[model samples]
Target: MPTVAVPQLSVADLDPATNLDAVTERVAALPDRVDVAVFPEYALTGFVADERACDAALERDGPELDRVRSVAAAHDLAVVAGYLERGAGDDRLYNALAYVAPDSDTTVYRKRHLWAGEADVVTAGDERVVVETPAGSTGLVTCYDLNFVGDSAAFAAERVDALFVAGAWPAAHSENWRLLLRARALDGVRWVVGAGRTGARNVPDAPLTEYAGRSAVVRPDGHVAAALSRGERDLVADLDPAVLAEQREFIPVLEATENDGSTRRNSRPGSRNKNGV
Candidate 1:
């Protein structure tokens, strides 16, 4: 089992220093046995676009993320955090998340699916990012990617054990966020750890909005193993491979559907049976 922590933070008008410091402090406060810590989307830069957005953007090897890497190394755990990345070009930017592992190179996962207005400011990522860890193989996804099940299904096909979702979802559509997290976990049969931002954020050029901070860890059976309420808190839970195996033995959905590349279409309900049956 892998102990994972999702720190729910209120990212309202926080500068880069304060944001990074918040994450560092959170990691410092987490349980020593926690294998991974996932932070909310735009936790470092807040949600800003246009010229101001570019200013908040950071290079992968820049000083900003160097501090984050140090935090991961110090904690001796893998840290996943969202930030604005300065893209290849001067004007380009990416809604990126970096996975920093102790004694390992950081892997950046750009947001492949952009939100409604994000395309104007951020370029969409064309590749999927997954990494191996001592606990298991972990995959990454951003806010809007939850709407697409195929992306998560792809990870399931690749035998990903856990998925980390970093999101800055608004308070209005929080139910959708909850539903998607559970759905992804159930459908993919993998542990889904979701970290979301809270409080009201009034970006310089963007609209003022409040974040929904229902950060949670979902089991493979679509149940929330652990969750934090609408505030600044940490939701830590263990993702047991035994539980996943047991659930898969009961349902066997991911293995059957992905390995065979075909799905059973039963007209009647309760037509399927368990793997051991």
Candidate 2:
């Protein structure tokens, strides 16, 4: 069983320093029994509509991330936090998740799909990364990525044990957030751990938009095991591998349809890249 904690917190708009402090304190507060702590999208740098986003983008190897890594090392738990990344060639920016572990080097997963105002700000990612962790093999996805079934199926083909999601979905469509998570869980018979932001984003000269704020830990059986409607509370739950094993044994959903439903049992996994976004 892998104990996971999903912290439902608000992003301090364009303020990485304050967010970094929160991340440190939150990581330190988790119980030793927890193997990982997941933070919501833009956990460190909140989103902005225009070029001001460039100001929020941090280098992957920048001091900010080093600080996060140090905190993870000290706490002895994996931390998956959403952040804005500055491209090597100064391309644009990327909506990314930083998977910082105690024993391994940090793994960064960029968001493949950009939503609404995001397409103007960040470049899409090209690869599908399944990171192996102490608890299990897991895949990462940011906000808008949850709506795509192929992304969920792509990880299912890789046989990932879990999918960790970082989201800042709007309050108006909160049901979609919960719906899509369960759909993905059933799609792969795997655990879906989602951390969503709460509170309102007060960007200058723009209408204030409130976040959905319903963070959830969906079981392999597609049940909502634990969740937070709104607040700064942490949703902690132990994901039992046996539950996944039993679900696979009984339903065998992934076994029947492999790799985004393009390949059935004996078929070769699709040659083309399955765009998961």
lDDT of 1 by residue, 132-171 (tens): 7645777788988999877877777877677899998889
Cα lDDT of candidate 1 equals 0.80
> Candidate 2 at 120: error in angstroms?
1.0
Q: Largest TM-score belongs to which candidate?
A: 2
Model 2: CA > 4 A from native:
260-277
lDDT of 2: 0.83
Determine the backbone clash count of candidate 2.
0
TM-score of each: 0.90, 0.92
Q: Write the per-residue lDDT of candidate 2 for residues 1-277, one digit (tens) a residue.
A: 7899987888898899999999898888888999899999999998887888888888877899889889888888889999998976667788889888875367778888789878877788876666776557787888899888787878888787888999999999999999998888888888999999998899897669999999999988899999999888888999988988998888787776666533212111111123221
Model 1 lDDT at residue 197: 87
Worst 10 residues of 2 by lDDT: 263-272
Candidate 1 clashing pairs, residues 3+ apart or interchain = none
